[model samples]
Target: MKLIIRWLLLACALVLLTQLDSGIQIRSFGSAMWAAFVIGLLNAFVRPLLILFTLPVTVLTMGLFLFVINALTFQMASHLLEGFQVQGFWHALLGSVLYSVCSLVIDVALERLLGPRFMPPPQ
Candidate 1:
Protein backbone atom coordinates (compact mmCIF):
# COMPACT_ATOMS: atom_id res chain seq x y z
CA MET A 1 0.00 0.00 0.00
CA LYS A 2 0.96 3.66 -0.16
CA LEU A 3 1.79 3.74 3.54
CA ILE A 4 4.25 0.89 3.16
CA ILE A 5 6.02 2.59 0.27
CA ARG A 6 6.35 5.82 2.24
CA TRP A 7 7.76 3.94 5.21
CA LEU A 8 10.26 2.17 2.98
CA LEU A 9 11.42 5.49 1.61
CA LEU A 10 11.69 6.84 5.17
CA ALA A 11 13.77 3.81 6.13
CA CYS A 12 16.04 4.41 3.16
CA ALA A 13 16.37 8.05 4.15
CA LEU A 14 17.29 7.14 7.71
CA VAL A 15 19.87 4.65 6.48
CA LEU A 16 21.35 7.28 4.22
CA LEU A 17 21.41 9.81 7.07
CA THR A 18 23.21 7.43 9.41
CA GLN A 19 25.85 6.83 6.77
CA LEU A 20 26.26 10.54 6.04
CA ASP A 21 26.60 11.75 9.65
CA SER A 22 28.44 10.28 12.60
CA GLY A 23 26.07 11.78 15.15
CA ILE A 24 23.22 9.55 14.15
CA GLN A 25 23.61 5.77 14.33
CA ILE A 26 21.47 2.78 13.57
CA ARG A 27 22.77 -0.56 14.68
CA SER A 28 20.57 -2.55 12.30
CA PHE A 29 18.44 -2.02 9.23
CA GLY A 30 15.42 -3.40 11.04
CA SER A 31 15.82 -0.87 13.82
CA ALA A 32 16.26 1.92 11.33
CA MET A 33 13.14 0.83 9.52
CA TRP A 34 11.14 0.71 12.72
CA ALA A 35 12.51 4.06 13.79
CA ALA A 36 11.42 5.52 10.49
CA PHE A 37 7.93 4.16 10.97
CA VAL A 38 7.71 5.51 14.48
CA ILE A 39 9.07 8.87 13.45
CA GLY A 40 6.56 9.12 10.64
CA LEU A 41 3.75 8.20 12.97
CA LEU A 42 4.83 10.75 15.55
CA ASN A 43 5.15 13.46 12.95
CA ALA A 44 1.75 12.67 11.53
CA PHE A 45 -0.05 12.44 14.85
CA VAL A 46 1.79 14.01 17.75
CA ARG A 47 3.51 16.80 15.90
CA PRO A 48 0.31 18.58 14.98
CA LEU A 49 -0.84 18.64 18.57
CA LEU A 50 2.53 19.99 19.56
CA ILE A 51 2.35 22.64 16.88
CA LEU A 52 -1.09 23.67 18.05
CA PHE A 53 -0.01 23.88 21.66
CA THR A 54 3.00 25.93 20.70
CA LEU A 55 1.11 28.07 18.23
CA PRO A 56 1.83 31.29 20.06
CA VAL A 57 5.53 30.59 20.21
CA THR A 58 5.55 29.34 16.64
CA VAL A 59 3.86 32.53 15.48
CA LEU A 60 6.14 34.63 17.63
CA THR A 61 9.15 32.92 16.07
CA MET A 62 7.68 33.17 12.59
CA GLY A 63 7.51 29.39 12.29
CA LEU A 64 11.14 28.76 13.21
CA PHE A 65 9.98 26.99 16.35
CA LEU A 66 8.81 24.15 14.14
CA PHE A 67 12.44 23.23 13.73
CA VAL A 68 12.70 22.78 17.47
CA ILE A 69 9.55 20.67 17.44
CA ASN A 70 10.96 18.58 14.65
CA ALA A 71 14.22 18.08 16.52
CA LEU A 72 12.33 17.08 19.62
CA THR A 73 10.29 14.60 17.67
CA PHE A 74 13.44 13.15 16.19
CA GLN A 75 14.89 12.77 19.65
CA MET A 76 11.66 11.20 20.84
CA ALA A 77 11.82 8.68 18.00
CA SER A 78 15.41 7.87 18.83
CA HIS A 79 14.47 7.25 22.42
CA LEU A 80 11.54 5.02 21.45
CA LEU A 81 13.54 2.88 19.09
CA GLU A 82 16.19 0.42 20.18
CA GLY A 83 19.52 0.56 18.35
CA PHE A 84 18.84 4.06 17.06
CA GLN A 85 20.58 6.91 18.84
CA VAL A 86 20.70 10.68 18.40
CA GLN A 87 23.47 12.25 20.48
CA GLY A 88 22.09 15.64 21.57
CA PHE A 89 19.98 18.63 20.61
CA TRP A 90 22.45 19.67 17.96
CA HIS A 91 22.62 16.17 16.58
CA ALA A 92 18.86 15.89 16.65
CA LEU A 93 18.49 19.21 14.85
CA LEU A 94 20.99 18.20 12.21
CA GLY A 95 19.41 14.80 11.89
CA SER A 96 15.99 16.38 11.50
CA VAL A 97 17.18 18.66 8.73
CA LEU A 98 18.97 15.83 7.02
CA TYR A 99 15.97 13.56 7.34
CA SER A 100 13.66 16.18 5.89
CA VAL A 101 15.93 16.78 2.91
CA CYS A 102 16.51 13.09 2.29
CA SER A 103 12.85 12.24 2.64
CA LEU A 104 11.86 15.01 0.26
CA VAL A 105 14.42 13.83 -2.30
CA ILE A 106 13.33 10.23 -2.00
CA ASP A 107 9.66 11.12 -2.21
CA VAL A 108 10.17 13.27 -5.26
CA ALA A 109 12.17 10.56 -6.99
CA LEU A 110 9.61 7.92 -6.18
CA GLU A 111 6.77 10.15 -7.30
CA ARG A 112 8.48 10.66 -10.64
CA LEU A 113 9.16 6.96 -11.11
CA LEU A 114 5.89 5.52 -9.82
CA GLY A 115 3.53 8.41 -10.49
CA PRO A 116 1.54 10.39 -7.91
CA ARG A 117 -0.84 7.53 -7.29
CA PHE A 118 1.56 5.94 -4.84
CA MET A 119 1.51 8.98 -2.58
CA PRO A 120 -0.68 8.92 0.49
CA PRO A 121 -3.96 10.76 0.21
CA PRO A 122 -3.60 14.31 1.48
CA GLN A 123 -4.63 14.80 5.07
Candidate 2:
Protein backbone atom coordinates (compact mmCIF):
# COMPACT_ATOMS: atom_id res chain seq x y z
CA MET A 1 0.00 0.00 0.00
CA LYS A 2 0.98 3.63 -0.40
CA LEU A 3 1.03 4.14 3.36
CA ILE A 4 3.51 1.34 3.91
CA ILE A 5 5.77 2.59 1.16
CA ARG A 6 5.68 6.10 2.51
CA TRP A 7 6.56 4.90 6.03
CA LEU A 8 9.52 2.93 4.74
CA LEU A 9 10.72 5.83 2.65
CA LEU A 10 10.46 8.18 5.60
CA ALA A 11 12.45 5.75 7.70
CA CYS A 12 15.14 5.68 5.04
CA ALA A 13 15.09 9.45 5.03
CA LEU A 14 15.69 9.42 8.78
CA VAL A 15 18.69 7.21 8.26
CA LEU A 16 19.91 9.62 5.63
CA LEU A 17 19.33 12.56 7.96
CA THR A 18 21.50 11.00 10.64
CA GLN A 19 24.26 10.71 8.12
CA LEU A 20 23.83 14.35 7.11
CA ASP A 21 23.72 15.81 10.66
CA SER A 22 26.01 14.95 13.53
CA GLY A 23 23.51 16.28 16.04
CA ILE A 24 20.87 13.82 14.98
CA GLN A 25 21.90 10.28 15.76
CA ILE A 26 19.89 7.21 14.84
CA ARG A 27 21.15 3.88 16.19
CA SER A 28 20.00 1.66 13.36
CA PHE A 29 17.62 1.28 10.46
CA GLY A 30 15.02 -0.36 12.66
CA SER A 31 15.34 2.47 15.12
CA ALA A 32 14.98 4.90 12.28
CA MET A 33 11.72 3.18 11.28
CA TRP A 34 10.30 3.47 14.78
CA ALA A 35 11.42 7.07 15.04
CA ALA A 36 9.73 7.85 11.77
CA PHE A 37 6.49 6.31 12.97
CA VAL A 38 6.60 8.15 16.27
CA ILE A 39 7.30 11.41 14.50
CA GLY A 40 4.35 10.83 12.19
CA LEU A 41 2.01 9.99 15.07
CA LEU A 42 3.10 13.05 17.03
CA ASN A 43 2.61 15.24 14.00
CA ALA A 44 -0.84 13.78 13.42
CA PHE A 45 -2.17 13.83 17.00
CA VAL A 46 -0.16 16.35 19.01
CA ARG A 47 1.15 18.94 16.58
CA PRO A 48 -2.23 20.49 15.81
CA LEU A 49 -3.06 20.95 19.49
CA LEU A 50 0.26 22.63 20.12
CA ILE A 51 -0.25 24.85 17.09
CA LEU A 52 -3.69 25.88 18.30
CA PHE A 53 -2.47 26.67 21.81
CA THR A 54 0.43 28.71 20.44
CA LEU A 55 -1.62 30.48 17.80
CA PRO A 56 -1.22 33.93 19.33
CA VAL A 57 2.56 33.70 19.48
CA THR A 58 2.66 32.01 16.11
CA VAL A 59 0.63 34.81 14.56
CA LEU A 60 2.72 37.46 16.25
CA THR A 61 5.88 35.84 14.93
CA MET A 62 4.42 35.59 11.45
CA GLY A 63 4.29 31.80 11.70
CA LEU A 64 7.94 31.52 12.75
CA PHE A 65 6.83 30.11 16.10
CA LEU A 66 5.69 26.97 14.35
CA PHE A 67 9.37 26.06 14.08
CA VAL A 68 9.59 26.22 17.88
CA ILE A 69 6.56 23.98 18.18
CA ASN A 70 8.14 21.58 15.74
CA ALA A 71 11.35 21.59 17.75
CA LEU A 72 9.42 20.80 20.94
CA THR A 73 7.76 17.88 19.24
CA PHE A 74 11.12 16.76 17.88
CA GLN A 75 12.65 16.92 21.34
CA MET A 76 9.68 15.03 22.73
CA ALA A 77 10.23 12.30 20.19
CA SER A 78 13.88 12.02 21.13
CA HIS A 79 12.98 11.76 24.83
CA LEU A 80 10.44 9.05 24.06
CA LEU A 81 12.84 6.93 22.00
CA GLU A 82 16.06 5.31 23.09
CA GLY A 83 17.62 4.85 19.70
CA PHE A 84 16.80 8.25 18.28
CA GLN A 85 18.67 11.13 19.89
CA VAL A 86 18.74 14.84 19.16
CA GLN A 87 21.58 16.42 21.15
CA GLY A 88 20.18 19.80 22.27
CA PHE A 89 17.57 22.46 21.60
CA TRP A 90 19.49 23.79 18.63
CA HIS A 91 20.01 20.27 17.37
CA ALA A 92 16.35 19.52 17.80
CA LEU A 93 15.38 22.57 15.82
CA LEU A 94 17.79 21.77 13.05
CA GLY A 95 16.87 18.10 13.00
CA SER A 96 13.17 18.90 12.93
CA VAL A 97 13.64 21.27 10.01
CA LEU A 98 15.71 18.70 8.13
CA TYR A 99 13.26 15.92 8.86
CA SER A 100 10.39 18.08 7.67
CA VAL A 101 12.24 18.81 4.47
CA CYS A 102 12.86 15.12 3.92
CA SER A 103 9.25 14.30 4.64
CA LEU A 104 8.07 16.92 2.17
CA VAL A 105 10.33 15.46 -0.51
CA ILE A 106 9.03 11.98 0.16
CA ASP A 107 5.41 13.16 0.01
CA VAL A 108 5.84 14.99 -3.25
CA ALA A 109 7.68 12.06 -4.80
CA LEU A 110 5.00 9.63 -3.65
CA GLU A 111 2.22 11.81 -4.98
CA ARG A 112 3.97 12.02 -8.29
CA LEU A 113 4.65 8.30 -8.58
CA LEU A 114 1.21 7.23 -7.35
CA GLY A 115 -0.37 9.75 -9.68
CA PRO A 116 -4.11 10.49 -10.03
CA ARG A 117 -5.42 7.46 -8.15
CA PHE A 118 -4.38 8.91 -4.83
CA MET A 119 -5.44 12.46 -5.67
CA PRO A 120 -8.89 13.95 -5.79
CA PRO A 121 -10.25 15.45 -9.00
CA PRO A 122 -10.46 19.21 -9.28
CA GLN A 123 -13.81 20.74 -8.45
Over 1-123, each residue of candidate 2 has an lDDT whose tens digit, in order, gives 889999999999888878887989999999989998999999999999999999999999999999999999998999999999999999899888988998888888888988644567678
Q: How many clashes show up in model 2? A: 0
Clashes of 1: 0
Residue range 32-98, candidate 1, lDDT tens digits: 8899989989999999999999999999999999999999999999999878999899999999999
TM per candidate comes to: 0.89, 0.92
TM-score of 1: 0.89
Best by TM-score: 2
Worst 10 contiguous positions by lDDT, candidate 2: 114-123
Residue 96 lDDT (model 1): 97
Clashing pairs in 2: none
Winning model by lDDT: 2
